[model samples]
Target: MTLSALDQLKNLTTVVADSSDLEAIRQFRPLDATTNPSLITAAAAQPENKALIEAAFEQARAENYENGELIERAIDILTVKFGVEILKLIEGRVSTEVDASLSYDTAATVAKAKELLHLYQSYGIAKERVLIKIASTWEGIQAARLLEIEGIHCNLTLLFGLHQAQACADAKVTLISPFVGRILDWYKKAENVSSYPIDKDPGVQSVKQIYNYYKQQGIHTQVMGASFRSIDQVLGLAGCDLLTIAPALLEQLEQDQREVTAALSVTAAQQASVIERPVQDEQSFKAEVEHDLMAAQLLQSGIDGFIKAREQLHALLRQSFGLDEEIKA
Candidate 1:
């Protein structure tokens, strides 16, 4: 029998399970995995993941032997636990995000990223087995650029514009995740419309433009489409470097036996879009992104959401340690 859409995608794209639920990852067998603070908070609340959470605290107790220290330690412990689990199944890297509270602080973002990598290394995880997830702000990109030179790969998240991709490419980061569903969400809300063309969906268009630009410039930074609102959005960009899809949508793809074909190609990119000019510098890039309302709001909102989720996770850890969770609140 011919391959299903999911199988065909497996051939073209590095399927990434975008969830903190390790069980869901086992079900899909994605080649990679990604998790944000929000997903980690959600997963930690579940009954199944409670053991993992408790184990984190236990491991922390073994090290620092204090409630506050346990809480701090659990953050690294739980995160690496997820990465370790996923690494067992996937051949590629697993992305664990930095503390969202540090997104605006380039130095802090770089510090926390190194801490995460150190924890992974302590657990026998190779440096190549991880991609430090960072927000695509100017600070985040700068942090990633520094780490990339140290042999630490990065996955730049919350990317919503061509400028973000260009910056990341210039930084020579390992990968960039363009959020497809989130972009669609923004355009729909702005236009007061219910639907739009799959191919022309603002999110899809954003990734396509970034993808073409990268290929045209011969930038090796991978483009991974994320945050899909529907399978149609996922199907719309079938040949991206990677697509960190949710488990529910992965199931939908597995069940839908539709014919899948390449919607992007190097040949077409070379012929159609020419990078006749040099990449934008920081000043112009920042100015250009500031002019785009949707990108600005989405980028800020995405960062805010991560910060809130990180606060929630910290609250959970505090409560788990019999500390004052309200302080975290």
Candidate 2:
């Protein structure tokens, strides 16, 4: 019997579901799952998850959290609630993001991460089962460095350039999610092109560069290509350490019975010539990000998008809790 593309690809990479929808995750049965503010907001609005949102609200109410504080607490609990549910379905880790509003504050990001872990612990989930997803800003990477010291793993997200990847590896982060489709989007608009061939794709090339660099330097930081716009983009980085794909593309791969090939390997990386850079400090990291137009713009915009999604979730929670009218009055 011929294997589906998804099954064939799994042999070379760990497949992760990039969603918070319980049914979708159940169907895909990905080895791991990841959730961001946007996914959580969408999931929280579903009728099937009404109970989870209510539970989070009740828990916050019982703790005497009120008004703005209540909404904030509920959002955190709801995020963890989704993670708990996802953990029940997957054997590997679930990435729950830190509040994107705290992306630039290292201390605040660290504190929020610990608070999130504490919430997960209350539900009997181990720290090992969760990867605190943080933006790949210099401060965010520094926050991850602090968390890793305490045995708390992190997934540095919104990554676009090799500088960010290198800084993350230097921090010894457990994983980094380089946004594949987003990079392709930026290039498409700037270069005024509809799309490039899969092999010549800017997004594909970016991940290949980062993956090869890590392998050549013997870096242990795992690269999980994320935000894929299509199955071809997903397949373009075959043999990546991991790939957190959205359900739609996962479904596409599941239905196709195409042959899959490993496009990346450590053996090839060892033979490729790679340049090493000096470790980046706060000043240099900031300078490099500002210098790279794509990375700088995308990083800020990614944080802004996540922050907007979180705010939307807060608005939904307020209306659900009958505080929307009160806030207006």
Candidate 3:
């Protein structure tokens, strides 16, 4: 009997469930979990989660919040509520994102991350058990750096380029989640090509590029490939520090018993040519992003998408409390 592809991955990588679906995480039994407003919105629509939704709203009202404040507090509590459930089922930390609208506000991002930490603590969960996820914008990276100094770990997400990855390494943050599928999606749409050769797949190459660069530089900011669209993409980066995968793909791996091989080698990365660039700061980071069309577009779009999703979640919460009409008026 050959080992399943996922089994092979688990041997070399720390598998994380990239979803807010508790059942998916429980069934897959991944070591860690990650959630974002987009994922949470998807989960919020499910009938099974109605009780949790109501509970979050009730908690906010009990705190004497009114109108907009009630909605905002419920959003925070709802995120933490999901985190609490996820933490109960997994021993590893859960990555809960700060509001994406704050992506470019250093102080605001930092404050939001702190509020999330405080909320987790209020739930009796230690700060160490949570990774406050922030975007990898220039401001986001700097915010993570500040949080790191205060002993808070961060996962810099929505990453689309090596420049940001390099900056993240310089920041000495806990991890970087480079988006694999999104990059490929961009290239495919731009190039009008249906497919590329397996090994030449752009998304797979992106993660490998970041991973190799990290290893060659001896940077400890772990490279975790995220937003994968296919199993081949997952197998292509089998030896990443971590891979946060959707449960649908996890199910595909679970049902298949094919052999999986180690696709990345840190030793190889160390032996690979080093990519040299100046250390990044706010100004240089902005300039570099402007120069790279893909990174700039993706960063803005990612933030916009998350912000929209967060708003949707809030609207859902308001509707749940029968305040949607009142708020509209």
Candidate 1 similarity to native, TM-score: 0.95
Best of the two (2, 3) by TM-score: 2
TM-scores for all predictions: 0.95, 0.98, 0.97
Per-residue CA lDDT of model 3 for 36-117, tens digit only, reads 9999999989999999888988988899988988888888998999999999999899999999999989999999999999
Clashes of each: 0, 0, 0
Identify the runs in model 3 with alpha carbons over 4 angstroms from their true place: 326-329
Q: Output the lDDT of residue 186, model 1.
A: 88
Kindly report which residue pairs in candidate 1 clash with one another. Answer: none
User: What does the lDDT come to for candidate 3?
Assistant: 0.90
Give the range where candidate 2 is weakest over 10 consecutive residues by summed lDDT. 320-329
Q: CA lDDT of 206 in candidate 1?
A: 88
Each candidate's lDDT (Cα)?
Answer: 0.87, 0.94, 0.90
Per-residue alpha-carbon lDDT of candidate 1 for residues 1-329, written as tens digits (9 for 90 to 100): 97778998888777899998888988888888999989989988888777888888888887865655557668778988878878988787899999877887899988989989988998899999899999999989999999999999999999998888889998999999999988898899999999998867989988988888888889899999999999888888888888999999999999888888877777777777575545577788788779989889999999999889877888888876678754532
